[model samples]
Target: MASIPTILTTIFLFFLRSTISQQIHSNPDCTGRWIHIRRLPSRFNLDLLTNCSQYPLFDDFCPYLPNHGLGQKTHAKSHSWFRTDPMMLELIFHRRMLEYPCLTPDPNSANAVYLPYYTGIDALRYLYGPDVNSSAEHGLELFDFVKEQDSPNIWARHKGHDHFLVMARPAWDFSQPLINDPPIWGTSFLELPEFYNLTVLTFEARAWPWQEQAVPYPTSFHPPNLSFLESWIHRVARSRRSTLMLFAGGGGVSATPNIRRSIRDECENDTKNGTNGGYVKLCDVVDCSNGICEHDPIRYMRPMMEASFCLQPPGDTPTRRSTFDSILAGCIPVFFEDLSAKTQYTWHLPEEEYGEFSVFIPKEEVVFKGLKILDVLMGIPRDRVMKMRERVLELMPRVIYRRHGSSVDFRSNKKDAFDIAIEGTLQRIKSRLQEVAVL
Candidate 1:
C-alpha cells in the first residue's frame, strides 16, 4: 500500500490530468503542450489566489498550495528547499492555469480538495513571517504559502490570523462556522469592511447594496483599504468613444439619482457634438441568452464590441468593477473614483498615454467634481480627447487579457503598486520569521 502522502499525491495527479484534459474543449488557445502544470485557479473560478503560478510539483498536483505558504509547509516536513531553477519558472509560465479542465463547471472534480484558497495578504503571511527588518529586507522560504494552518495530523498555528470575506455573490452565507470564526470581515462594496483582514478592492463606488439585507449592519461599517491592480492607475489618458467597450453586470443598484441627474444635465449642456454622451452606457441586468451573472464574458462581450469607453464606477466606494470589466471587454476604462488607483496597482494603466488613454477622478473632489459622464464630456478638449482615443486603439491589443492559461501581468511594470505591495509584504514576513526563530 502507498503512504498517505503518496496516496494523496496520486489522487492529486489524477485530477490534475482530468483538469488539464478538459481545457481543450473550452479555451481555443490551449492546444499546445503545457510546460508546467499550474495548480492554482483564478478568482472567477474557485481558488483564492488566481493568476499567480506554481511550477512542476505544485502545479502538477497540489491544489492547496496557498500562494505563499505551500513551499514552507512542504519544507517543514520534507526538509527540502524549493528549487528556484530557471527551467521551473519557464515551464510554469508557459502552461497557463486558465486553460485547465477543472476551471469550469461542465465536469467538476468530485475528489478534489474542498479547501478554499487564501487571500494575497494571507498568502504573504503564510509564506513569509509577519515582521519588518531594519533594512526592510529579509528572505522568505521562496514560494511558500503565506498563511498555512497546521494539518489535521498536527496542531494548528497562529489562531490570530483573520479572513475578510467579501461576498461578491449572495449565494454565499457568512453565518457558517468556517467563515464567521476568524478575523473575517464582510464587505459588499470593495471599500466596506466586510471581511476580517482582507480588502475587496473595486472601482464602482456609487452603485452598491442592491438589496438592504446584504448591506453591512451596524452603521459604523468602516471602508476597507483593500488591494488594487496598482498605483498610478488613476493617472492615464482617456479612451475614445468611437471604438466599442463593455461593462460587467452585477446585483448592485443602478446609477444613483445624483449621478443620473448629472448625466442628463451634461447631455443638455454639451452641444459641442462629443462622445461625452458616448463614454458610458448601461446594459440589461440579465443577458438575453443566459441567466448567469452580468460579468460573464460570453454574455457581456456584445456591448464591449460596440463602444470605446467603458465607464468604470465603483459598486462600493474606492473599489470599481470597471477595472476588470473594461480590461476584459477589450476597451479602455474611464475611471471614476474617490481615491487614487495608483495607490493599489502598479502596472494597471500606463502613463505616457495618460492624457490620451484613460481617465481618473480624484477621491476628495468626487462629489464636487460631478458625475463621470459630465466630467468626461466637458473636461476633455475635443482634439486631446480624439488623440487619447487613438492611443487606446493602439494599446488595446497589448492591454486586453483574453481567456487563456498563461499568467498575465496584472499591472504595467516592476515598480507597479500591486507588485510593491506583494514584495513589501514578503519582506515583512521574512523579518517576522527571523524574530520568531522560524527561519
Candidate 2:
C-alpha cells in the first residue's frame, strides 16, 4: 500500500511527462508536422516547367532552376545568377514542402493544411493570354474546387481556419473591386467568404486584417548553405563603399507618384557640382528602363554593395523587391513613404524604431517641399550610419528565400526565410485553434 502523499507525487510526475511530450511534438523545431492538399491538379504546376517557354519572361525565369526543379548546385565558388519571377514562390513552396521533414503523409496528423494553388501564375496566364473572361472566372474554379472536397470534411472541420495560403504578390493584387469602381487587377479568390478565416502570406499586407501576414519579397540571391551566406557576409564587411546613395529603379504610376526623377536629377546635379568637401562620394544612378535591371543579378547587386544608402521610392505598388536586395547587400534603405516598409513587412522586420535599420524622409519633404535627397542622407552621422548598416546585415538572413531542395544540415542552426515562415505559420495556427476551443 502506498502512502497518500507518495501516490499524489507519482500521479503528478506522470501528468508532467505527458505534457512535456505533447509540447515537444508540437514544437516546430522538433515535429512541425503539416500536410499539403493533394486535390489540386498536377498539370497546373508540373506542366509549367515543360512549357515555360510559352509564358512571359521565360528567358529571365527559366535558367534559375537548371536541375529539373531540384535547384542548381552551389558547391562551386563561381557566382551563379538566379533571377526568378516573384510569383514563382508558389512553385518553390510546393517543391520544398515535398521534402520538408515536417510534412506529414497523413492529414489527420497535420497541424495545418497548405493549398498549393498557383493563383498568381494562373491569374497572370489568363490576364496576358487572349482569354479575358477566363481571368475573371479563375476564382470561381478555385472556390468550386474547395466546396466539392467535403468527403472527409477536413476543410469543414474548422471552416478552413486551419488552412494556409502563400502568395508572392502583394495583397492588393487579389482584392475585389467595389460595386461602383472598375476592376483594377487580380482575382476575386481572396474576397470569397470561404477564405475569411484562412491565413494568407503575401509580400505586402493590408493594415486592417489580422489574417494577412507580410513576408519578404524574394531576391535573386539564394545561397545554398551557411558557408555561402557567411562568405557573402565576410566579403561585404571588408568591401569599401565608394558611393553615398544609389537609385536603380524607374518612374512610378499615377496613383503612386514617386520622386524617382527628382532623386535622379539631384544625383546628376551633385556630380556636376562636386559638393560636400569630398566627404560624400558621387551618387550612382542606373536607368532601369534601358535593359534588364534586376534580371542580371551582378548589375543590380554591384551598385547596392558599393553604396551607403539605397534610395527606395514607391513603384507600381507600395513595396519594392529592391528593398530586400538592398538589405541583403548590407545597404541601408531610404524610404519615402511609411507604407513602403513601416506598415508592411511587420513580420520580418524588427518592432524597434524604423530608423534603426532604415532611413525615412516623407515624400512631401523631397518632392513638394524641395528638400535634397543627398543632403538628408548625408546629415545622418557616420557612427549612426555604421550602426544602421550593422542592423541591416543582422536582418539579411530573414529576408532571403533559400534555394529549393538545397542541402542544408538541420543541426547547423541555420534557418532561412522559408523556415521562419513555417515556424510563424504554425505558431499562428496553434493560437487560432486554442482561441476556437475556448470559445
Candidate 3:
C-alpha cells in the first residue's frame, strides 16, 4: 500500500491532468486569460500554514499568517494595516492568488496553470541550518512528483511552457549552483529540469531573460480598493517633503554587506538638513545603525513618506525590499545597480526605462571613482525632481496587493502587483508557445 504522502501526491496529479484535459471543453464565451490554479496536496501549502509557529525564521509566525499572510494586525490613526513580515510573501502570494481575477474553476478553460506551491516556506529548514547536501531535498521531492506524472496532456502539453509558479524569495535562493563543494546558501530548485520551462515570479529575478521575472515586494500599505489607492496617492502628492534625500538603512559601523559602502558612510551622520552657510546637505539619514529596524519596518516607511529620493544601495544582495517600500511611500528610488531595478522588473517599472521613475548612480562611481552622491542628486533640476516624484506617485498602484477578503467585494478595475504579474506570465507563456508552434 502507498504511504499517505505518495497517495495524496498521486491523487493531486490525477486531478491536475483531468482538470487540464477538460479545459478543451470550457466555455469559449469567457473572455480574458483564464488561470488554472493547481491544487497541490496540503503538504505543499496548507500544511505549512498549520505549522507556522515551527517555521525556522520566527518563534511564532502564526500572527503573520492571519489576514492571509499579511501578518499581525497593525495600523496608524484608524487605518487598516498589518505587521507584514518580509519572509511571509509565500503566504501572501498564495492568498492573493485566490483572489486573482479571471480564475477558472474549469481546468479545460485555463490558458495558463498557476502552481500554488509554497516553495519558499518549504525551503526554510534546508536553507537556514541544514547540511548543504540536504539543501535540495524539498525541491527535489516536488520535482520527482511532477516528473512521475503520466499525463501527456498536462506537463507535456507545450512542454510545461504554460505552467507558472510564484516564489516569494529572490531568484538566487532557488538557483544556488550545485557545486561539488556547495556553500551554505539556497536550494537547487531552479536547477531542476521540471521547473526550468515554467514562468516564475519573485521579488528579485535574475537579470537574464530565462524563466524568472521580478515582482514587487510587499509593503505596509495594502489598499482595500482603487478608492483607497487614489486617496493615498493624492495624500502623497500633497505631502511636504523636508529634505533633499533620504537613506533609512544601515551599513555604517561595518562595510561588508552593501556594495555602496562609501555611500552609507557618507549618509550615516549627515545632520545638515536644510542648509549650512549656503550649503545644502545631501540627506536626512535614519541610521538603523545596530539592526534597529528588523521588527520595525515602519522605521523605514514613515521617513520614506516624507522624503524625495530614497538611496537604495544593494544590501547583502543586489536588490532590497526597501526599494518597493519606497515606491509604496511615493518616494523616488535612487538605485546603485542597474540589475536592482532596471533589468529585473521589466514587466512593471519604468513603463519603458528606469528613468521614468528612478535615479541610477553607478556603483563604480561611488565605490571606485570617489563620486559624491550628494553632488549628483543636488545637481538635478528641481523640475526634474518634481516630475520624478509625480511618476513615482503614478506607479504606486502597480506595486501592491490591494484586494483583501473584504476588499474583493469593493469592485474596481485597478490591477495591483499580483494582477500585473499573472497577466505578464500568461502573455510570456503564450508568446513562447506561439514561437514553438511556428517551428
Highest-scoring model, lDDT: 3
Candidate 2 has a TM-score of 0.83
TM-score of each: 0.38, 0.83, 0.86
Better of 1 and 2 by lDDT: 2
**lDDT of each residue in 123-220, candidate 1, tens digit only:** 22222223211111111221122233223211112211111111222211111223222333221122222222222212111223221111110100
| lDDT (Cα atoms) of all candidates against the true structure | 0.31, 0.69, 0.71
List of clashing residue pairs for candidate 3: 22-108, 23-108, 23-109
RMSDs, each prediction? 17.4, 11.5, 5.6
Name the lDDT of candidate 3.
Answer: 0.71
Clashes of each: 78, 0, 3
Model 2 CA lDDT for position 161? 75
lDDT of 2 by residue, 1-439 (tens): 2333343354345334433433343436545455545446544454444444455632324444443222333334544336555666776666555545555445567788887776666655554544434444555665566657434466777777788878767887777543313445566556766677888888888889778888887777776667777788888776678788888887632344348767866776775333552434668876676446755667768888888899999866878988998998899999999889888776678756687999988888887888988778778888998999999888888888776546656214667677778778888888998899899
Which stretches of model 1 miss by more than 4 angstroms? 1-11, 14-257, 264-300, 328-330, 338-340, 350-356, 362-383, 386-439
Candidate 1 versus the native: TM-score? Answer: 0.38
